[model samples]
Target: MRNFLTAIFSKDKSPFVNAKAATSWCKRLQEIDMQSQHLKIHAAVTAFVSEERPTTLDSLSALLLIDDAAQPSYEAVCYQYIANPRMSKEIESRLWKQITSFAVDMAGVYQLFVQSETESGKKAEFALLMPKVLARSLHYLSIQAKWHYFRFEKVPSKLWTLSHQLYRLSEIEGCDSNPFPLYTSHAQEVTSCADEYIQMLMLGSLSNNNLSVRQIDWVDQWLNQWSKLIQMSRKFQEGRYHLCVNLQAPEGVQKIQAESEGEPFRYWGLHDLMHELEETLRRLENGATPRDLGMGKECPAPLAVELLKHLDIFWLMSIRNSVVQRSERKKVAKIADIISGLDSIIGHVRFDNDKNVRKASADGRGQVDYDEIMDMRLYGFVSTRTKEKPPPNKVVENKQKDWHVWNIENESVGGYGAVVHLSENEWVRPGLLVANRLGRQENWHLGVIRRLNRLGDDEVYVGIQSLALSPIAVSLYMEKEERKEQISLAEDSTLGVADLPNIRTALYLPHQIEGKNVNTLILHSADYGTDKIYRVQARERVFMVRLGSVIEKGVDWVWVTVFVISQE
Candidate 1:
């Protein structure tokens, strides 16, 4: 029964999913309460798997598309869903339980398969079952690693016990099918990623927090298991790369064969796996700690910074594959891309830099930005991003987000200027996040404020560079509604409009602002309780901005949603 359940969820189409009716039945089973109906479904799955199943290629047509909502919905409900996930609470503990159950179940099943190998009668029967059991077990381990490491939602226990058990079973000469070093390597990689993530969070959140025994154990185990996996899995590639693709598929290699018909998908290739592992580790290096995104407040709040800090991972993926539909993910990807293109500073012009820009332009790749040269006075400030450790080359000192006020002396399309008063200890460096003055939200539309020139002893002129814009809108408040302030982008002000939700209409775009196009929100105010979606027709692509963490009652402009919405 246990093995059959694995088969049903596994990448391959087993007899458990033989026909349209069977697939429909599987979908129905997902909707039913997993706790109440698991036993019956287990029995049905068991019965189907015991029979001789079809191996026809035609069955491939039944697999779900990448975007099919039902597929993720089913997976979410049965294997990894929460009834109601509060940002304040850790995602459904059932996912943790299910993960634990699979690890335990697979260990027992491996033992049973090995013991049953003795009886020739059983060996013939177990052949088909063993391959899938090995495959599905590996498949879910990747998922576990993703949620635990990539999402930083939960901490994961080491997979050493289960991998070791399978390793011993594989050593048995005729154990039907052999499990490869895939388990061993993955066990180490997944565990290491999780440990590093925890350690990083503790460090980032470490103003007054002490390292607990649990954190120590996590770090210690990661150190212990990483060595063991290297020894057990054998040093095939050595230090060249953590993962690689196979030119011709080898029998000993662990691969998800079904998803590709004749090929594998899940952490199968060396290149993809290496990229996956590196990407996860990089998140720990540069992103919000588990403490930042986790449900528990005991962990510590994320280093106060832009959403961009938590979004470094998205920048690693190709642009097309980059964006996810979720509001936060979409917002992060868009902002990350937006900031990436803003790497232009008047200082530090490598000769080859213009060559690269010209090549990129000839490729017809980026947006054609026209430079507007202007001079003006504006108020701005500089704040450093929170770091996990003191920067190596940087002078040893405070790493917190230190706010220092500046006087903006000039402006341009690419960047703006300001005279900064830095203490003797401080230096105006390149690639720092500058809070370009946008009303009360000082850090709104952040740009890199860098050293342009020296005016005198205490004043250092700095430039803020980016292709950024902000629109002024009246903020409406609704308790429990996610976006506290919705920017109504209409030409006519909310004068005597019948639906007068908020009487105060004193909203103004920053003085001296130009080149921002606006549109009208259909309803003057968002509906009584729920959030309202406004259809805006922008002459050009206009964005509705949301600043990360400012929810207060005021007339001053603040972004309710940081990610942009296309006016078109």
Candidate 2:
């Protein structure tokens, strides 16, 4: 009442003063005694303020701008309360809710701008009237088609830098908000393909709010692209790298001495091969004198050929007597061929080094699974798009997730082996960011897809390396009964995050990686203090992880260690 009287009677009631008064009133509402009464009173007050203003697109845009303008003052006041422990926390929670709520609402507005079929063919002529809608629509469209690369993927799933593009386009072309310089041109350039039909729809978006989409065809196009990639990636989903191999090449063929361009080796000697075979057998027999295969005496070429012919017939007969499951040798080869072509985009083929050389000493059937392997049912959610340098602890928060229920095949210290269905595994890939949660628990562990394996026609077993567990829930104050009753309760929480200060580092991987992959990544200064992002170049699987990050004094230097996790 005293504050209200001051607002009415005092000389100063300027825009800033009125805004300050409104903010103070809102802040005071937090101090109301009863939780129920507190929420109810504030709700009534807010509803009253909103009552006079109808929330059209324009009104919402105005409110958003106003909220943004007032944010700094709220933050300043929040900072002022830093020394007061309780009030500091209370102020922070209020600020977070305001900011988060605004963001959530703004996201809805942007989505509406792109998706509103009713608003098709509407020319956004007046910038002052519809700046938010126009700006966001143009921004999102540019992001979908990166300056150089055009993603055939879903719009919301893409990432890009469009602030400069939007500003320039808005100022220069005066088409929509920021005219997409190459969006329409790219469509015209792809006239050779039958997919020109799809490109036409893209052109519609580039021109105006006229998105003339054929729903069935659009879905088919999206699914077809995803399906082909998934089919190519299936072999990789299973423990594809652990395939059994014959260590020594089939013997007895007449040596074909050959040399190719830049070949490291040429003309491997027959005597050297025989000696190598004898030595390997001696080691296998545990230093017992190996049964000599007459390697000491060279057999005539005719006799060697005859022996090899008989051996080939025997091997063919053994394969004919093999198990009922058909070999996927041809399909595996097809997958590898396709993957090899796209090695520049998706990561290179990473082979597992689980050389079960110990199996030669065993019964040769294969190692058995132990009972201790935890069989927990869980869901793994994969992020749709790739990130070069993701923000810290925000892979999951950065949306558009496709999730699948997977059976945890086994558990390890820092990782887990899980099986996902064909529909699910299609989206999963090595080095891709993923979130794993056991059952329905909200708790999630952020990680990378370390490996993928295919079992048969349906299932894909994947290896996951956990980086960090999701932040702890702050709702511990609520009892189980209370939680059940008030599941949709308006909760207040504070993030104890420090200010972001710039720092620098160098990219020097501590682990041993293949020579080809080692030099592929060059950690740019722009990526310093960014999230642990996964980026692969050719065969190079790259990401940055911090070992001892601290805000150092004097130089403001923060040392974040980088790592390249791969198998040789």
Candidate 3:
């Protein structure tokens, strides 16, 4: 058996025998259109790298060539999955595992090369390899961090420890400040080991901050420029700087504490970076072009300002201290059987109409069964168009199979941290609007999902921010002059004013404060227009209102303030 195994192993040859060979192989792999084929090729390369254990200068050159060539495909797959909320769980898991394994294997190979040169007492080779080692190791670590951040999950402690150890290793070799050309297709930008280290630290600090996938991507893009402006050193710097990292701790960068003591710690100040960001923001606000100010070409001025403000808060204070305190509790809550959207929220909240109430009373029940309500609402609410005026676009059918039963793991003034079986709610994602009924309560409160993290294959945790305690269902009609003209030209002059067309379903949320006259409505994204007037019909009351600025918006809904023009 030993002889046979040796023969089989000896027959296995490395595709990366030389730099040119590695490049050719990578080009062939890139030419393959199927992602599944790429996965197969990646697996084979990974196995060879891990098991063959090539330990020569020629092998190092080939490995670097392969790394540069393979990165684009791996990152493309990673972002493709991250941006898609409705991706299959099985495919996501399989692809993510392969990508992460590739990163780990690549980083390990580079680290091994550094170790081999150091132990062999080859000073010249070691000096030449140190900067590449630091840059590649940090780049791979950043990939791991990006994986977690995009998934809205916390990075593992072991990963943080490994990152800190790499930065510490660079310090020991006196090459922490050595510059190397980081691979990019656009320009040959030079970066140091310290810059990469700080980028990792900044990424770690953003965990649990409830940033959406797009916002996280924006931060990652801006960090490429912002990280260059940051300064790190062993000595404490003057000014209002609070960022520090302890090399001995199994954590990333954190707020500096006056009383805490730790050796071999690095203090990084963001004062200079903050100044640059503020200056750029000022120019943007004053009508400066984003590309001219070094921002991304596609990024708008408002988005640039929003991202800058978000970063400013983190640089000025500790995220842990800034977060709201959540009360730890284990209580089960009954979630409604409705997919998140303006239509679903309105349907669920308005289920107890006069007709349903009368039917329940006649049957000797206080209210109808929630499950029956869901069934009726889902299948029986298709809208029909009239010959004169067609109804607005029909609401999409709800796809939920059953009610979500979530366990309230924690609670705070703003929201609840809940967990449910992943199989029960595969569509749950950030920015999803949900309706929850707690403990047999008749009234259902509305909330939006702000964060989501999978515990494993079976369960998922989500953070939901409460929006409204008791949202009232209302119908809205665009208050166009043409609408008034149509009403006047009706065949039957007795046609009521409420019988107009283009009625859109919306939710009316009352003011939170008792003496405030503020009114807000959650409407479908298509129904909202700047400065458009709307006639609101709420059960027995009718009023004319005008749309105000949008407070928040999602894929399917928009929350906007409204002013009551007149009540009848």
Q: Give stretches of model 3 more than 4 Å off.
A: 1-102, 112-129, 143-156, 167-181, 184-339, 353-403, 409-413, 439-441, 481-499, 511-517, 529-531
- Candidate 1 all-Cα RMSD: 22.1
Which model scores highest in TM-score? 3
RMSD of candidates 1 onward, in order: 22.1, 30.8, 11.8
Q: Where is model 1 poorest over a 10-residue stretch in terms of lDDT?
A: 370-379
Question: What C-alpha lDDT, on a 0 to 100 scale, does residue 450 get in candidate 3?
Answer: 67
Sequence-dependent TM-score of model 1:
0.27
For each candidate, what TM-score against the reference? 0.27, 0.22, 0.57
* Candidates 1 and 2, the one with greater lDDT: 1
What's the residue-level lDDT of 33 in candidate 3? Answer: 67
134-249 per-residue lDDT for model 1 (tens digits): 44443344334333432223333344233333333433433323333233223433333222322222222211111222333233333322222222222233232222212233
**Which segments of model 2 are wrong by more than 4 Å?**
1-49, 52-68, 71-96, 105-129, 134-568
lDDT of 2: 0.31
Task: Give model 2's TM-score versus the native structure.
Answer: 0.22
lDDT of each: 0.32, 0.31, 0.68
Task: Give lDDT tens digits, candidate 2, residues 7-51.
Answer: 789864222223454454445544544343334433433553444
lDDT digits (tens) for residues 291-334 of candidate 3: 88766675677887766665654454342332334445445454
